[model samples]
Target: MSDVTTPKRGRPGYDQAAILEIAVLAFNEYGYDATSMGVLASRLTLSKAAIYHHFSSKEELLQLALDHALGGLEGLLLEPGAATGAAIDRLAHVLRGAVHVLADRLPYVTLLLRVRGNTDVERQALTRRRAFDRAVATLVTAARDEGSLRADIDPAVVTRLLFGMVNSIAEWYRPTGPTDAAHLANDVLAVALNGLRTPA
Candidate 1:
């Protein structure tokens, strides 16, 4: 008689992207500074060593998550529509694109909105955020100069108010909610542009 042995199966492994998604969600839930690698491992049902295999440190994870969000937003400024059309239309495209990005990357964007420059990683993200804001402010200025938007308000204020409206979505928006990305973008544009547009 011969004896046969069965091989033990190894535990499932998580790739960087999957780990990043879970980590970003946790950061949004518990906050980046508060979330430790052990906490993330627990959330992922993996050992801390397993997570360490993919990410060198928690700050690395934070940087990657912030990059995901900032990349989406900054990329919008480079779109052809952003550069070609009337400043008002370009601004609309940018705002609409931003709404979609927020909806699509809600957790990431949510985490980004919560960043307060507590660390070097956060300060870098803040600097990038400020650059994006400055680009939008320029668009707002162009739109105002072209008679598309109202001139009474400073472009900086308009930029802040416009983004304040857009950024608010991170607070309460849900992917499974009643309003979808397109409709939300439309509602945002209507409320924003109608109010900002110079009256005919």
Candidate 2:
């Protein structure tokens, strides 16, 4: 017998979850439009048939990845901290949760942020994102009503600014570095809740 052990496999043992993870990474690495089932198969070291066995088409993979990101965000709204608290505190909780979700699901969330409504999946993702934004805007409006946020700013504007700050992290955040998700969350909340301008 040869020293090397031969691999015995009919179809490579790949599951849908594992494939979705790699698919998200591939989409993040190569633009969604550029990443094809063939490219994914090559990346996963599987045949086109193997990939197709898990996903019907490349669009399915994209939809799954978008769902992963959007699911995490939508779940945040259901959390106790977000659901029941003072408006300001609840907004803070949501902001922190958003940062945590972004850090935890960086690649998926990054892919989500890059969607341009070019396809049905992208359009649905965009609609979900806008809904999440509206939910945050509702919190901002509540905070303003309670006098926790600056009176000069419109709640809609505040929502965009706060989320814009939080969402921008997906562009540059690295998981291996010194800062963790909690630290990032704190930093985001600090800058967002407290302005840079000093008292005159």
Q: Global lDDT of each model? A: 0.87, 0.86
TM-score of each: 0.90, 0.90
- The C-alpha RMSD in Å for every predicted model, in order, reads 9.2, 7.7
TM accuracy, model 1: 0.90
For 86-135, candidate 2 gives per-residue lDDT tens digits of 99999999999999989987888899999999999899999999999999
Q: Candidate 2 at residue 62, lDDT?
A: 87
With a 3 Å backbone cut-off (N, CA, C), the pairs that clash in candidate 2 are: none
lDDT per residue, candidate 1, 47-152, as tens digits? Answer: 9998989889999988888888888898899899998999999999999999998998788789889899999999999999999999999999999999998889
For candidate 1, the per-residue lDDT at 95 reads 99
RMSD of 2: 7.7
Tally clashes: model 1: 0
For model 1 the local lDDT of residue 122 reads 96
